[model samples]
Target chain A: MSTRLLTKYATPDESGQAILKNAMEKLDLSARAYDRILKVSRTIADLEECENIEAHHVAEAVQYRSLDRSGWAG
Target chain B: MLVKTFGAAVTGIDAITITIEVNVTRGIRFFLVGLPDNAVKESQQRIESVFKETGHKWPGKRIVVNMAPADTRKEGSAYDLPIAVGVLAADEQITSSRISDFMMMGELSLDGSIHPIKGALPIALQAKADGFKGFIVPKANAREAAVVKGLNVYGVESFREVVDFLTGRKEIEPVEVDTDAEFLKEQARSEFDFADVKGQDSVKRALEIAAAGGHNVIMIGPPGSGKSMLAKRLPTILPPLTLDEALETTKIHSVAGKLNGHISLLTRRPFRSPHHSVSDVALVGGGSYPQPGEISLAHNGVLFLDELPEFKRSVLEVMRQPLEDRTISISRARFTIDYPASFMMVASMNPCPCGYYNHPEKACVCSPGVVQKYLSRISGPLLDRIDIHIEVVPVPFDKLAAQKPAETSNTVRERVIKARAVQSERFKK
Candidate 1:
């Protein structure tokens, strides 16, 4: 998806935003990883019948980015 | 006198209708024109033999057959039926007015028998769209072409039968199919089930998410971790194929000449696993003729690449664009064709060269940078396209020996279908 569509559909609420910001800093996620995480979180929330993405959904989506994490094999 | 008939040329997954125009002139030769390839050009010899065997005399006067939209290269022996039919009608041998009302496609055998041709489904679809009253295909291709409703599909066994049916001398039944009923009946039969596997619930969970969101995934595991087994069963847990998807998948398989003679439509999702030692042409599809490759064959299904690092670097390099656009376009000197390749990619790799990197019990024998070197075979750009990465370890002996019954793939599939329903609703504009 384009960056505009990603921001429009997958952007989470305030507290979810805080969780994403913290995860971005701690995990050193790239912008690509960030967009993917948002999309996955949106799916996770949809799975749970949640209209908005929750913090738990974002956390679960972050776990899926294992390959993007540097030094993962070590 | 001039007579017209119709045939179809399958280009990529769709078919283009070719109008065969035949006229008799004063000379004593036959001419086949309109950029026909060698296979199509060779149909004349078979036609001559078929006419003799069927007790019909070959036309001696000069005859010219022109396939309209001549820029499109007609590249198969399937044109034999149409050309032969048009000639007979033009020469006043078969005085049937029904010649112009249908599309005829088949390879004529020397014994006057009609041979099955590839891409019958796409050709029939094109004929129906163009308002043809009927489609005449070889008996072996009848069921495949009959899946398209609102068109009479006649399956003829030999050239004599075609002549008799067209001349109103013999009655031929048009094939009929209840595509919806057949599709529903076949939806419940899956070859593999998640319940058959002993353990690896975590990996199954990851695959479940991948199915629901249509995400690509990779698994890193040691040997004997059941990666291939899990990959094979992924299609079982995904939602059942809708009728439209079944048709789409069937068209790709039909153009690739992969469908069996009797199977009208594909009931189950396809799972294609090409070995790592495949060429770029075989993997992503490009050759002198530009046939659909493994990716196109794997359309609307899972393409499992086992031992991902073992594949040639150039092969993986060629797949990046198709992975992004979900369609592979091949540009030749004369024409460019696009094949749909929207498959969910499932790839597996060992953790390192020795298959023991970060293993709980195994000691790594490979020295320092060797592990990194082995991992570098799969380029980073390809990895970026994959959204889910999950690690798997061999099931412990206790887990393997446990008597507990695992959850069936059907049960997981129910939830996946529900999730997909939500996704479609959310995305519906």
Candidate 2:
């Protein structure tokens, strides 16, 4: 569920890429995992009951992958 | 038909009561109101699954969950258990009249276990403040919420457990916390004593002054010097948090999801050591929905930055305000969140890039100009905020090999506690 949230909103420029990478390695996830991020974005859209995914929702979904965007100490 | 339950909404470190109103009607959809975030809004699916898994029929009718008063924002999954239970009771799936006096909270897993949630301290405190009779949180968070007085705190591991307790089929005992006892245990002895550190009496003296005045300090030294180790021991000497201070500290940590849940109140001062590569936003904290950062977590405690110059310039710059103001104000478009960050800053950096700039035993590899450039990475203004500056030199071979029993952490802590006591007494007046 959390993965889908990451794909739709999180950008590779932010930490989301690293978080996605780590989850992929640790949990045997695939490109299909991108669907999880999309799902997360979808859920975020649903939260607002908006007809489409907003820029802010996509931005937030990406931000949760903190380590990817900024090379933070894990 | 609709039913209402009470939960707590945490802002910064403070928690206020939020009314969760569930309405089931003859309609086609699920609606969650009251400005819920993604986590809160998606809770319907999780809660619905839990209901089905627990042998209760899912509400086929249109369900609307309105978190009131209409304008306030609600975040996190902590509201899941309460909302789920409220729906069940209201839908007549679980026949219970006893849920009225007891507040419940937890994140529902598909398989029926109740997952842990954050800010138990603030939520429990809010429950007590609102005159709620009791609270039921996840088992892991029971100890934390139990710290609040005048509230019966119960911990449940599964949706069935909560249902059983609420429906009077089974009874769940309330968890108890002894704040006084926890304080006494914290006061007992420290593991790292000042006596163990050798040949840096000057640094120790500087630390003592910092402790007395609650001032920030910086230690410049070569590699293998005890700067990092000394910073770790600072909390041992720091005065224990006052009851009010402890609660305040706990709230920030709770909101940040840093509290492990064993300890409710933070009697001991926090010592946060974020690595050098931290971001400006992560260091000071910022997002669409702002959360507490390393500085906020270090409230009323110490923030130790080792390899200080290695941190990004922008990241360190963000700390300048909080360093001076003793608090950080995160301005989001919707709301501004302020977190207390009145902590003693203890930073350590090598005199030069190679870390052998001032070593007597080893030759300095970096040229003279290089040393200045490396030091220049830390801005003059940031350095100015630090009240004490000292150099830590390597221990002499004789001192390192000496058989003398160094003074223990207990000895240093006594003096620190005494100095802190003096300061507290002064602040009281």
Candidate 3:
């Protein structure tokens, strides 16, 4: 997705913002990962028929990014 | 005498019509010009042999056959038919005023039989766009050429048939196809479905989301955890290819010579799983002639890289440009060609070298340093292109033994389609 589409379609809500902010603090994600999380949350919200990105949708997408890779499988 | 016939040279996924102009003057030798490669120049021998074998009087005059638009290098033997016919018509052996009404492409055999040529669909499309009266391709490529409407398509078996058709000596039926109906006939059919799997609801959900959003995915798990199996079934739940998407995909396949013997239109989303040993050129589309590679073959579909880390890092690196731009551009010193490669990349890798890093039952035998080494084979930049990460766990024996069928891909596809509808509506601005 282009940056224009990313900002237009996947901007998070206030509560969703805090959830992402918390995850960023905890996980030390790269700056590039911030945009992907929003895109995925937008998809999750779309799947659930939500017009706006919700806290839980952002939370779910965040969890996918934290899945075990160099560590133990979650 | 001068004769003009038409053929095409496939550059990238499209074709440019090459005018085969044959001019016969007072001399004995043949001269082929207009930047033709060795294969095209060698068509003189094949054309001569076909004339001799079929007992057609050869025009012993100086035959200067030129493929016009002098800079474009004509590469293949497919130009054989047009060149042969141009020579024959110039000598008035096949005297027809309507010869230029059709675009022709086929390779001639020693005994004058016709062989299939590549890019028949694109050539057919270009012919229709150029308002040609017809397209004459080999019998084997008829179905593909027939996919295009508003043009006469004649599939011929031998050079004799072409001559007869052009000279009005015989009538050949133009191929008729209801491509829309043909595409819809098998649109919903899938060779593999989600219901075939016994368990793993979470993994299925991730794949569903990925399909709905056209997002890339990565599967990390131990061996025998159903990663490859799940990756193979991703296309089943993908929304079926639209008519335009199918045509685009089929054109790429056609120009690559991969669809000569396959169906004219691809009804389902393509699921291509090239082996990990694929080279940089084969993975991303580059060569001397520059054929569409596996990624372009998987356009408007899925490209599953099974054992992702097993692929050479350089091979993986070449995909980064197409992943971002949705198209790959190959540039030589003289020219450049771009092939469309918009595809969902679904890749898989074991969590560790021993393939059991976090198995539910089997203990991982690889050391910590070894596991890190295995993970680093896939670079971070490439991994960033993947949108979703799924950790596949092997289903237990009881779950595998359950006789109840899981949710079918058709059912999942409904929701996926619904989700995509919402996306399109949201983006309708």
Candidate 4:
């Protein structure tokens, strides 16, 4: 029997956690944005052929929240 | 003598075959029967006029034309050519030996020229399914019907040409379309691109995400912030349509009579921006004879709503269900039909009534709570359905006059395609 290809990818590690914490504190991102960030980071990792979600991927994903800033509306 | 030929009736983008039978008996009056609407009943006048104009014999005997099954309603003058041909064959003015092999539909002018009919694609599809050898349609609808393979589509310009072909006196080659090559050629060209927009890089990034994830987006900004300009370019970033999607979209457009002469497959995705004053029935697809609406017409493409709050609340409310289901179902006492309404919604609106509620450099003129009131015009449910809410700021004079061009749509589309590929692969698991 042929083995099925695994669909799941590797999760974020410690460096990824630091990036997320930095974005949440600095950007004041919502819980929804937090989840979206992780998903986008995973995609970025997939694009780069990386086994784990890297810190740079998380940083790039967080940068997408340009509209989420509080100062622009005020 | 009695003769039988065929036509079709379109309902909700599908077609049902209609058989037209004509018999010549020993009398002087014409009798037309079988559930024909005013347009179909009036075909007798057109047919007689066409016969007189073309120098064809109008049978002196009693001529009766019947369209079966009598239970279904036959609308439009598409039956003009079919009934005329059946009468001619029955009167022995034209050969009848090979009449049953083809299904014919077209509107006949007084001078006997054939006019285009709607729903040619669906009718051709039904004819092919019903084992008809060929479909004879107006020359204008030839390319539309040619999209269907395994069916001989003969397009004629006038009654004389049709008679010449049916009598074996002349030959008419069936229209053929290389659907794939045509689709690829058309896909290479796009009318709008992101490179034209001077700035709003943040909004472009948000739209890229929305396109990649199939999420709906809303852009709120002051006037002249380029919200509408940005929304129009979203289709170029989304993935090109597959063949099945092109056919499905073409069928809806064909049934709507939106495909004009010599139009082949619609390779580019549609961008429909109906005015804000559109009614509830027009936006979501409903009527006595239910035709597809803007949302359904925008199938597999983008539906941009500029000045979203300017739309009547009830009209926006009607769109909520289709937005969720990706298909709008119209229920009548006789039948229920669903039109595909799957599309990317990109709505834009000014920040407030004064149009400068949150402008970076302009002071708000509206009252304290007026901005909230304006925002509340778009219902909570509709806002909830939209995943991304972007704020667009106008580009500065320096940015607008900058020497470097902004990123082109092709570059953004490449990343969107890659992201979509990743998502589909993930979903497969």
Candidate 5:
């Protein structure tokens, strides 16, 4: 949840682990909760009418769920 | 017998007179039929209790209350006193022919006191337009509504007083408001006195030009560089509200239930600074029933979005069209509502994520890429809409401590008012 972790580990191009991390904290979800982030990412993909959840879409969705405010902020 | 009277209810900013039909039937039940919100539905209990306290028999028969044009959702408890008065007057318990000449509105307490209702100015204007002799609203709202001339505006304290007045048992004087005084007060407080701000004279001059031209502005500054303080003061230096502009601004606040019952028109321009966390629905305004959002609330005034980059991109992006068109039209499957949002935008943001990236006296820890990315959070198209952009530097310690009677708001405001008058004359042409 630290800003440093977002800056260091999370890339704007990849989904990384922030979504799963958010689901764990917000939903007290287990590692299995990665699927929920995937689902949400899929929904956003559908909104854009994309054939699949592209790397950027998933990454954006994950960024949206970031517990570290810095990662999601512009 | 069914007795009918009409008073206005707001659907967004537009007010439509509702037909209040009270029928005292020959049964032992009471029914209120309308698409009333919980607040409106609860009026029955309030009305009946007031009846008991006033020593009037709650019509033992099946009493039916119908708010006609019922398809339009009726919210708020303002209808309670109207319906109560309608029932009492209909039953001939309180007799007065004057009821037909006036529009009555207020929320009734169980003990029969009238509580203030929102949108008094709009409702009063609507009543006047309908050619009603006068309007009877809560005493608190009377002054607000009194801003409307050519109409007798009565402010009543208790339901008993309203009942007594309407029945010719007592007389209530109509309220009067000093709109000129309100206007003069507005001319006195210039938004952010440029004199008080010691440094950043360039930024202040830019703001002055923006205020003069009615242009959107953005300020990029490090934390505690007086960006917020400057934004807050913009309204003071801007042009005063014309009577028409004041009425329009007052209507939006009324619909949002933001009017705090000053009982006079808002002569000052509005200044709305919504937090970044505000939802799209709350910012642009939409519901099962449409209400004004922040953009509409900021009409005829300034809408300051501080920490602009921190706001959700989607939420900020949605404002693009409204920013260009000066109106927001929210379309649902069933209905579409358009709210006026012709407001001057003044948004502020930090140079980087840490808010100290470009501080003159501080070290820059954030990389250049981080600064660029933070600025990119606010889309390019949105940035294009803003006419003025300036960077604010921190004031020196000496300037902050030295107060040799900085230029007061009144002096700066006079210049702004003059510029506004120029705009008004040009627009009229």
Candidate 6:
């Protein structure tokens, strides 16, 4: 017998993938930001009555990082 | 003739019934017994003066007043009305069979007017629990007692009115307050709103999250950055108080005598901002007779500590346990009492002693290690209990003067409610 990990929900579609990739490369987003963006995107999708995370949802979630204070002391 | 009437003694936010027994005999002296404090003992002079001014003759015979539960120390002048009534009834000035049906408490002025007494709510609650039909209190305290259902609360103006009501010459209507309707009607009217704040959208968002999750938050900023202003509006965005929470909070205020004769249910969340020079006992609640302090007074609401670093470290340290447990326990030699202290802690402090350590337009004057030392004054254990930390910067003039309206607290509150719904669903698993 083989053990397998359980996947709960469907993965994001192609447009969502493109938006996340663009945010990572252009904004130099870290892994934590990546997770936060996904969580926020899920919330945005839930708010918009969508069953899956969409590209516009991820874009809206990425804008919440303006308050991030990473390496501003120098 | 001998007569018995009832009053209540408050002990740690609860009330215990005290029986006042008055005996009039054949002498020309007066006596007051029981383990009463000086204030309770002083009720006799006030009662005598009140009776004389109200056109009632003081009994020429000897009078003896004994407060039951002789072992427990009764404090405060709340026993004045009961003692006076007992004397009047024993002297045959007011003959009524219904004197024992009501629990009466008030402080009597020399002019015979009834003054408000502390702990009316707890006394009313005890009356209801003990199967009393009605409670007679000062007009200022009637509504406080009226919050307790299944009990008639009579608010009287003078000792004459109490006499007339007891003798069935005049009927005094009990006060009535629809607690739920009043709470909903007044909860929407906050004096300070987030829309009035010109800028600081990020700080507002941080506050919204803190309010949603019931998390402790600390704001780090320089002076004139609107940290204190932002904290004051935080309560306006949090969830409205349920009727049970409002009653509980009102009871704590009633015990602390902070209601100041506003006898309505505390519909709005409390916002307590103690000064930096507050003592440890004043913050956490302790004394010879333990009373609710700032944290307990802020029950079901916000406790904002402005200039958090300036507070004595000892005072701040005393709040650590209650901040985690949401209740404070004060222990004495014979007993320990618990006061509900569940409050969201919102604190603000400048970055350094000079208040310009990290200003955008200004240079830092404090040395490198000074800022760290200033921050270190707030101990690690105290800071560990706070869940959120956000830094605030001054808003530019253009942002402040902009005509475009920012989001209101109601708008943020709606989103917060939805977020809380999601969190509750997730936590239910």
- Indicate which candidate wins on DockQ: 1
Per-residue lDDT over B375-417 for candidate 3, one digit per residue giving the tens place of the 0 to 100 score? 8788888877777998899999999999988999899989999
Superior candidate under TM-score, 1 versus 3: 3
Please list the C-alpha lDDT of all candidates, in the order they appear. 0.89, 0.75, 0.89, 0.86, 0.74, 0.84
In terms of lDDT, the poorest run of 10 residues in model 3 chain A is: A65-74
TM-score, structure 3 vs. true: 0.97
In candidate 4, which residue ranges exceed 4 Å CA deviation? A1-74
Docking class for candidate 6: incorrect
Clashing pairs in 1: none
Better of 3 and 5 by lDDT: 3
Q: Write the per-residue lDDT of candidate 2 for residues B1-429, one digit (tens) a residue.
A: 677887878777777888888878887688888899899988888987887788987777888888888787988888888899878866777777777687778888989998888788888888888788899899999888888877999999999998898888898778988888887787555666677777676677657656655667778889888999888888876766788888888888888888786777777888899988788888887787788999989998999999999999989888988887788998877778888888889999888888887688888888777877887788766765664567788889898888787666666656666655543453465
Give the distance in Å from residue B379's predicted Cα in candidate 4 to where it truly belongs. 0.3
Query: Which candidate, 2 or 3, has the higher DockQ?
Result: 3
- Give the poorly placed runs of model 6, Cα more than 4 Å off: A1-74, B27-29, B60-62, B422-429
Task: Give the poorly placed runs of model 5, Cα more than 4 Å off.
Answer: A1-74, B190-192, B396-429
For candidate 1, write residues B142-236 as lDDT tens digits.
99989998989999999999999999999899999889888999889977999988889889888988898888899998988899999999999
Candidate RMSDs in Å, in order, are 1.6, 18.6, 1.5, 4.6, 14.0, 6.7
Tell me the RMSD of model 1 versus the true structure. Answer: 1.6
Clashing pairs in 4: B27-B62
Ranking according to DockQ, highest score first: 1, 3, 4, 6, 5, 2
The clash tally of candidate 6 reads: 0
Give candidate 1 regions above 4 Å deviation.
A22-28
Model 3 clashing residue pairs (backbone): none
Q: Against the true structure, what is model 1's DockQ?
A: 0.57
lDDT of 5 by residue, A1-74 (tens): 12343233222233334444544565343332244345444434433444444665555444332222333223
RMSD of 2: 18.6
Model 2 CA lDDT for position B248 = 85
lDDT for residue B124 in candidate 4, whole number 0-100:
95
